[model samples]
Target chain A: MSERAAAGIRIERVVKIFGDVGITALNEVSLDIAPGEFVSILGPSGCGKSTLLRCVAGLDTPSKGQIVVGGVPVSAPPEHLGIVFQRDALLEWRSVIDNLLLPIEFRGGDSRAVRPHAKALLRMVGLEGFEDRYPSQLSGGMRQRVAICRALVDDPMLLLMDEPFGALDALTRDQLNIELQRLWLANRKTVLFVTHSITEAIFLADRVVVFSPRPGSIADVIHVDLPRPRKLAVRTSELFHGYAGRIRTLFEGMGLLKEDE
Target chain B: MNRQSLQGVAITTMTLIVFGLIWEAGVSYFGVKPIVLPPPSAILRELFSELPWYLGHAWFTLIVTLGGFALAVVIGVALAVLIVESKLLEKTIYTVIVGLNSVPKVAIAPLFVIWMGTGAEPKLAIAFLIAVFAIVIDTVLGLKSVPADILDLGRALRGSRSMMLWRIRFPCALPSLFAGMKVAISLALVGAIVGEFVSSQRGLGYVILSAQGTFDTARVFAAVFLLAILGMLLFAAIVRIERWALPWHASQKDYSPSA
Candidate 1:
């Protein structure tokens, strides 16, 4: 999607099972994400989208197959990859800036050098006046923004987001999606976001990968050739509806759609 | 002071004065001797006149209480960590600790005196025994109470085991640790007094015993009053330390209980 020659993530037939029960969480899932591209893995609940994301981030070791990031096999979480979880997961004890400083501290990076960058990233995410507030003082959406700033603070090469906006209300989620697109346009980091919302996957992703239900495998990969710098109005366009319909059809074929029909 | 606090203070002062007046009047009107049920005024005079002697005894009791409490905190927290870190150890030792806690610690005081002798050692041992179990149990619960999602975040961040403990587990467990300390502090005081009751030469318990032996009711009342004051002071100090340590706690935020 980015016209880059190098691949950011290359998952080759990854499989994961929990314990001796041999209950597969993910099976033979393989895909590649190009450098500086935005990809979304879309699926219903219990479809192992999260499990696959965790494997890519090296949070979970695949029982079989390999995951490579930036041409290196991922045995552990690399310092250059940033992950934002569904929950804000902000340290209650730390101030907003300190929360952003955590990963840098863990990586033994220079916080002094990164402090300005951290502030800039916060401003980009629309959190300029909230540097002193604790996570508890902020609303849910504001906290998620802090979490995003924290993820990007270390200047990571890839951003792996696990339903980062799933917990927010519709309006907040929509606002954040626009902000995310602007930030992505400027920063141009490779992103792999997991989400249950088809509209979100269609709107934000350069390409969307759909997964089948439990013991999941890749069902399809849909390329979104829609124009860049997407806005709220773009979500109401015919192209956006067509993309959503295609993802909906994939879910329907897999017997995963029940509630949103 | 606010009206409610002022009312509380007034009520407390009035209750104390009324109790003292009634005791004095009852002793005098009922023709009670100084040897039995002495008037509150006599006890107050005795308390002030022998303040130096009582202070020394108070210091001895305080030392034993604090020492035992420190020992309990160390041992309990270490044991809790060990158990929580290993499932096998938890399964084997948790039941044993519960069983030990069920036995009345006061009944074990004489055994401690027999094993450690009639000095501060036995008192310290008794106090440690009384305080340790609560700390261990509460701390274990606290450590385990850390949400799975928080631990997952640490894991996702690739935090090392020690990093996880220092950054996530320990801070999260602090409120429970303080709760355990509060309960243990009171028990530590009780244990020290109980130990002194069994076989001590220089504590409030010793003074009370000697006064009772000679039927000096006023001195007995004076010694009891000192012990109560000591307990209240120790409890208050722990509360102050808790406030200083956990300024972010909900209980510490704008909390001003009347009186």
Candidate 2:
């Protein structure tokens, strides 16, 4: 991040090793995200992008080095953390409103006290009337919207998403990206989004971090200087294509991009 | 084949009617003795005449079956949760339960009678013994059915063990739990009857036994019909509860008339 501590997350030479023989996933990867920054981690499959995000969320630990969030080392699940996975992790049994209240319930707080706030979040995400609906009743995109709201309802300073829109179709993914940008514009929560899509990373984030697979490490970092509150139109813009082209060439260098380009 | 469709109810009704008519015609045409092969009409006649007697015995069987089923649910769920939550318990309890189930329940019926006396306690014990296994096994399967991502969500959300169990595992296990209960309900009824067959002063099983001794085949047949009715109702009640409790489960999405 250009601004120190403004990204609100600092990863210092974090290394992750798996198994006894020491298969390293992330090798001494270090990054600093400024406060209220929207940073996307772009990587190929099996890259430590998700591992890096998980470290920040305290879902996974580093074998070496440290991850400090808001001046505190993340030893366990931080109380202020909100996570959204590729799959919409909504409890089908509960209504959308109830699912939104899950973190509050897990934190053992008065969930009912946050009812009005939850309803407002739903409205903001264009899901006002869908509060009473179950996850099954909602469409795929709709469910993801509910998921985003659930992540924000806890008022976490940092939002960690692992391919949150990867499961959706192209159109729905674009729609969600716009919605996410709008939400980020309004609240400015420091977001660490992990995705395989180069276009998505460039479209959504203030800064995009690219990773190399097999002992995953930061390959390249690109600063997206596009205007905020961006829409699908930004994806077709020449500057947006330039950023995507630069990231794609890095993948091509790693032999991940097919010759079809 | 849409066998679970609402129209399947019509097929069931028609099949029962056709079977009854066939039995009636076969007995009438062959002039078979009621003691050997009682006609459906003869069984119905016995049912009407011995309604009060059947009612009293049926009530005894019902209470015993219900008592056993209740204990099976509570103890089975508690045992399942214990096994699921603790690795040591999981290692030992599943084997013990399976081993206990493998023991010939018919053989144990008499032992229960000897230990618990000739009253309903013996029946209750046998019923619980027979039904609890299904509850434990099915609930375990249900609890384990939670997807890894969902479990990851819980962990990422900092969900405690109880929260995971009650909010995630328990609700997820309910459909399977009900499936187990449906099987357990029938088995519990059979267990109660088995106990009565071994030794009991009152019960439809006792009525059947006394009828067999007196060569009153129609009365025995009538007692059996009552038992079938009870089993069917209990099964239906369990299915009803499954639908009511887990309205969100995909299995309940069919909107069948039963739902």
Candidate 3:
């Protein structure tokens, strides 16, 4: 477990252009994420927020600038990095527990050694006894929970989530947001979460980084002074509403939401 | 099997019996000569009396079909992987396979006989050639059908190429591979019989040809009946293996008694 230390990320003036059309997906985006801080990137659809997360995960290489993780330059996927996608992406053929052990198998680690940790992660997410259920048999929210367990199984230092709970219903989304905040409080790993929901962003992050519409760069970063182990009731609080209102006003200023409409 | 499947079997058996009786009554009413078309009873008699002789020929054909199918699976899967993993093979080798597949396999059966003689080798080769196409095409589709997100997940884990192929792509392809095997197995049987028809001293195909020469309709009917039974059994065997191998697949649920 000594190798399970959290790693900070440095994204320095990253620029990404796609295809021959010169369509700029990300333009000179830069941010520094402290170790163990939970940062949510909030933006609208096609705002390149997901692309920024992909760059940090090393699934896409920026056309310009660089990303460094834990004092090492990113050329390929960095060590102990885990990622979760919006679709859950669980292998249907493998059972829940086996899906959790996939990263271990890919990394050439002993699966038998990681079985206990896998079960513990499942238990943490309220999926205590579904170890043998296939992904097809699970509900959407449950499948996403298993996906989260799979990401954490190898104890990745840096976790990147791209709209991980965006597909769920409103109630399930709130439940997952609370569970995710609890998990972060326990582990304190550096997490870079990308989402479009304003309430979800501030509820689960120490700082929410807002991005402008495409050719996306950071528009604003708002620090949340909310206390740890925050309950659902916190969302109704004055401070929480204040943060959401601020983000809405910013979007309105950018013409993303027209006041007349 | 459960009660429903057993009932299904019973219904199928009853239908076959009724169909056989209709054929028998029609032949007697028409006063058809045995040389034209023997009644079902005569064919049954011929089958029972010469059962050992039929078994010997049937065994040879079965062996040839199985050998060809096994070879097709091994080589076809390997070829598909190569084509998928390399753009060069996809452009060159895959195009050639598609072009050749368009040519009717029966047209080339005689070529195999001339090359490999009347032994089992020629029959095996023809069967493999006919069956390998389905295996390659379907396997290629399966290998390429893995979801992009799954591929990205594999990449994020820093998995090697072989690891991705083995752990992710291969298992994901199993259902499609089984579908190909079902088609290939039947094609292999057709290839085997075609090979025997072109040139052969043994097997059911030889029995049918010799019976036709002597105008022994009963013997010809016996061999034909055996061939039909063999094809069904082989298809059923493939289906059984598919069910066992892919319990995870959605198709299995449709036929499941509980579902």
Candidate 4:
């Protein structure tokens, strides 16, 4: 591990307008994420939570605002950061171990030196025996695990994930949630996870930043005081339901979730 | 080979033998004139007697086809990359290639003979011109087919444009490139024969043409048989290369998606 301090993020009034017709995806969205915080941006589909994540990753630039990461403004994908998409994005030609080593290779590090770290990460994800397996050989859940290992192989300070479990089955999603929490507890890297799952956001995040529907802006921020090393059973607790109920009510206000007559 | 592939080979060989027997019986039963359509037995006899002579002409055709195919791969891949990388090249170069492909390559075979003379050069040139189009089109398709999320992942990782192309796009394009090559190799053989037809002193095409002029129907059948074998071998060679280079794709083919 790098032993470097985790990075904080500051999204200062970021406004993103797409194309000539001026579709405003993010409308003056701003948030402050402390170092080592696990923050999830939760909202409905077409909500600019993903847009916010993209701005922080430097994959897209905000038209009217700036994003500061690790004490410096993000220009072109700031150093010591990693991202995972909904799809595993593992190079089909590469084996699982090689896929894990991709970020190191991209950063001009010697892959030979990082091989041990990559192996350790795979072991951490319960994929030790699958080091030589191709992505196509693995199930959907296993591929996503490889992708998460790939992102963490470089020991990034800030990790951004965009709906990383959206495609997974419910059982796999629950399992990955537990694994992700364990991993997060171990490294505690600053994570800005984007998702539409209310329970998932509250279960995984230190704070859930809810966004309104399209032309997305922060609707509310709910802090989860649930203890560390949270198990799946914790999701059924009264306190967990309190946080979920608050988020549900917020979504109901935004016309995202409705109570049937 | 595995048991499955061995069984496949056995079945293919059995089918070919049945086809040969049918042709032999039909020719003899119909009492076809030797000058019109010789029996498969007669063609086979000619092939065995002139084995060394037929081998030399077949070798010439093979060399010209392979040479042209190699040239097409190099230039075609380079051009496809340029077309993908630059909007200007896509607009100008790709448009020109598509336009040039529409003109019949056989119609222009004689032009290559006129320009490069009655040597291997014209045959190779014709083969290249005929084969290049498939390479460019399939490669372009493959390069563009990379998933959007994968590109976004590359961008998030700060991959340089050249690095992304080399590490991601090019490898992703391999299966499609192999598909193009398989088609091109067969087309290259056809182009080589056309070039030889235009003007050549050697190759299977020359042997066929001279035999046709002399009314040596058996010799023509033998040369055509050799050409068919050559084309099949070249195509099989490409399929083998595809399997070797794309182990992931081959293994994935056997994978049941329900898993």
Which predicted model would earn the best DockQ?
Answer: 4
Summarize candidate 4's per-residue lDDT along A8-118 as a digit string, tens digits. Answer: 999899999997989899999888999999999999999888888988999899999999999999878888887899988889999899898888888899999989888
Model 3 chain B worst lDDT run, 10 consecutive residues = B250-259
DockQ of each: 0.27, 0.44, 0.49, 0.62
Write model 4 residue lDDT over B1-259, tens digit each, in one string. Answer: 9999899999999999999899888988888898898988899999999899999999999999999999999999999999999999999999999999999999988888778889899999999999999999999999999999889888888899998999999999999999999999999999999989889899999999999999999999999999999998999999898888898884435764233
What 10-residue stretch in candidate 1 chain B is worst by lDDT?
Answer: B250-259
When just chain B is superposed on the true chain B, each candidate scores a TM-score of: 0.89, 0.93, 0.95, 0.97
Error of model 4, residue B79, in angstroms: 1.1
Q: After superposition, how far is residue B179 of candidate 4 from its true place, in Å?
A: 0.6
Docking class of 4: medium
TM-score of each: 0.87, 0.94, 0.96, 0.98
Assign candidate 1 its CAPRI class. Answer: acceptable
Tell me the whole-model lDDT of each prediction, alpha carbons only: 0.86, 0.88, 0.92, 0.92
Worst 10 residues of 2 chain A by lDDT: A1-10
Error of 2 at A184 (Å): 1.1
lDDT of 1 by residue, B38-141 (tens): 88899999989988998999999999999999999999999988888889989989889999999999988999988999989999999999999989999999
- Root-mean-square deviation per candidate: 4.4, 3.7, 2.1, 1.4
Q: In candidate 4, which residue ranges exceed 4 Å CA deviation?
A: B250-259
- RMSD from true fold, candidate 1: 4.4
- 1 versus 2: better TM-score goes to: 2
lDDT by residue (tens digit), candidate 3, A124-197:
88998889877777788898989988888898899999999999999989889988887777788899999999
